[model samples]
Target: MEPESGVNGTAIAEFILLGLVESPGLQPVVFVVFFVAYLVTVGGNLSILAAILVEPKLHTPMYFFLGNLSVLDVGCISVTIPSMLGRLVSHKRTVPYGACLTQLFFFHQLAGVDCFLLTAMAYDRFLAICRPLTYSACMNHTVQRMLVAVSWVCAFTNALTHTVAISTLNFCGPNVINHFYCDLPQLFQLSCSNIQLNELLLFGLGVLMAGAPVILIVTSYTHVAIAVLRIRSAEGRKKAFSTCGSHLTVVGIFYGTDVFSYMRLGSVEASDKDKGIGILNTVISPMLNPLIYSLRNPDVQCALRRVLTRKQAMV
Candidate 1:
């Protein structure tokens, strides 16, 4: 295929994704592993989403956010895994420039949405534990829906801005992306033009989209922790911690990996170790979210059991 020229007359057609492993013998194993992870991620999140939707008892603010989160997990994993699996199986690791940008767009969009959704979930927990009397009034159905909508809008806008900026860059040669997927920083490294503006925007938007939500989550949890500590009854403290424990765990895993990946933007180049970390945030985290909630949150477990029992009875 003839390489397509961008507006800058740069003859760039596609990018070669040097996938997770270069060994031909390990391709099947890697494909199987990631494919299984993808399946588990989809199945786990779908079950959570189903349990929440079917169980009327779970139709509260917390589960509402959980449903949104499950959806995001499914999306976030789906955005990258299928293409990755295809590359692994076919050994055709080349992705068209347009398709690469599309992946970048959806990946960032869903990831950003996850960050905000987790923050919203934290706020819901804060209200429930720290201000129980006002929790219902504060996090009504309308308010919950509005919070989710705002998250999507903010995430989409951020993703769109980066995609537009990335599209404008000129790629003269060496269209190989080192990571398993097409990421913004990796793309920045490949761009032949000045990337100071892109870097500034990335840092600025990173703070707004990622850092802000992380701060809010931390603040919410701090308040929750203080409130739990002040409770006179041990059972009350336990219950309060249980309420937010899953969210905190998830936040730690996600933010820990993501901050490591993005925060050191100017210091070093993208390494294979960075790709491994990326896999944690992109693949492993989504698979773990449902497991953490289902195992830690009694409500989700009971709801899932109810869903399964009903299915068996119907059968």
Candidate 2:
């Protein structure tokens, strides 16, 4: 079937997403592997979210932000994995132009939200460790809610700006997206119109949306490290380090893959290696977040154990 022309005569209605692997033999293997990862990512993050809500002991600023993070992780993965899985099984791996735009919007929005939430979580840790006396007062329930709300608003605005800019461009002939997803850079490369404004917005807003939060997280952790060093008792220092360590690990993985992908935007062509990095950023990171937090933190483990025990007793 031929693709319908858009209002702009040259625009194609749909695009073919040339996914990660081209070989038919590898499709099933890729599907199974990613399906398991998706399930684990959803289940683990939901469990963490449920535990935080049910356990009275977890009704603190730190757990509140952790709950938000889990939610964002779940959303970020959901935006891409389902579509990618569908494309893997179907012979005709085509996505509607509108659907592609929508996917791009949500993917970036959720990613932006994840960045801000991590920064907020780091700030919470900083206050707890660096200014213990003021921690509770500074990160009260009201303030915590406000911070999460601000993160969502900022992220949504950033995604909207990019989507709107992309909508204005004309796609004349080539309708094939090189990667598994409808990423901004790939879309820019396909446009018939000059994308100078789009490129400028992508770089400027990308930095504000991603770079700012990263800077905040690093600065917060620096202060947290200094505060930990001042503690004379080895046990006290160990406890403090453990508290912040899980978050640091997650931040490192999320930022590392993103920097690799987006920082090198000068290259218009997408490679197989780029798709692998996207998988790590979108699929692997979300799955690892719950595992890292639960395994590293005894408090969360104990809370999860209690929840499971109570469920078993009722059964």
Candidate 3:
């Protein structure tokens, strides 16, 4: 087909988002489900943020990073879920070119932050478990902030790489992305221009951003396991595992879904199966993270109770 949105002046303006759930019969049902899920996700993450901020008992490196993860979770889901929800019911599932790119950029940026921050938390656990005496010095306030700052910087840089690569592509007719959101692979299928180099970039950067973190997290946990095993008492082992257990669970879910979905060859067309998996990474993970990480922790629970009670009294 001739070029419709390309270097030539015939640049097509917007893209049609043919969302994951296509059935008009089921759109209403799916919309309500996803809409409620989105609300719970935002509210859950916000509660975590508030709890972390208000609870001085939780003013530590681990909770600091957990708070960041909660923020990223809220952002990552918000970036795509709203648009996907709109696509479910609206007759016109159109997203402006600029708006779609903006969504894509933030999705990558926040997701990258999520990955890096998890890795950082793993290291914090490693120090706490293996080198308890030096953990405080190694993971001081300055270092904690630095790790988070670096995560944001590195993630932002990675996102910029993807956004620039995607923006340069040409989109001819059939400017429709099949997936719920503007995922890189789905966008690749729409590009009329050569994508060899873009595919190469995705593969290279995907490994750097996703693969590297997995390796680091695994290495850190390996050391953690060894340290935990060395502890003679059962209580000692239990206590050690408790510190990192929630983080490990989150890492598994985040990486399991993301690496599987985005790590596929860019040349491969995004399938319905991929969109189904995307829900796990984007929607379910965010909703579950707060519950998994906070409700199980006594500090967060007490803080939430106190905050709620205060709000009730004020009203």
The candidate maximizing TM-score is 1
Segments in model 3 whose C-alpha atoms lie over 4 Å from true places: 1-10, 266-268
Q: Which 10-residue span in candidate 2 carries the lowest summed lDDT?
A: 1-10
* Model 1 segments more than 4 A misplaced: 1-9
How many collisions between residues are there in candidate 2? 0
Cα lDDT tens digits, model 1, 180-231, are 9998888888888788899899999999988889889889989989988999
Native-vs-model 1 lDDT? Answer: 0.88
lDDT of 2: 0.87
Model 2 Cα shift for residue 108 (angstroms): 1.0
1-315 per-residue lDDT for model 2 (tens digits): 233357553367888998878889999998999899999899999889888988888888889989988998899899998989987867778998889989999998999988888999999999998998988899888999899999889999999999888888888869888788898878878888888888889889878988888889889999989989999999999988888888899999999998888777688777787898989988999999988888978779888888778779999
Q: Which scores greater on lDDT, model 1 or model 2?
A: 1
Q: How many backbone clashes does candidate 3 have?
A: 0
The local lDDT score (0 to 100) that residue 92 gets in candidate 1 is 96
On the 0 to 100 scale, the lDDT of residue 237 in model 3 is: 86
lDDT of each: 0.88, 0.87, 0.85
Error of 2 at 248 (Å): 1.0
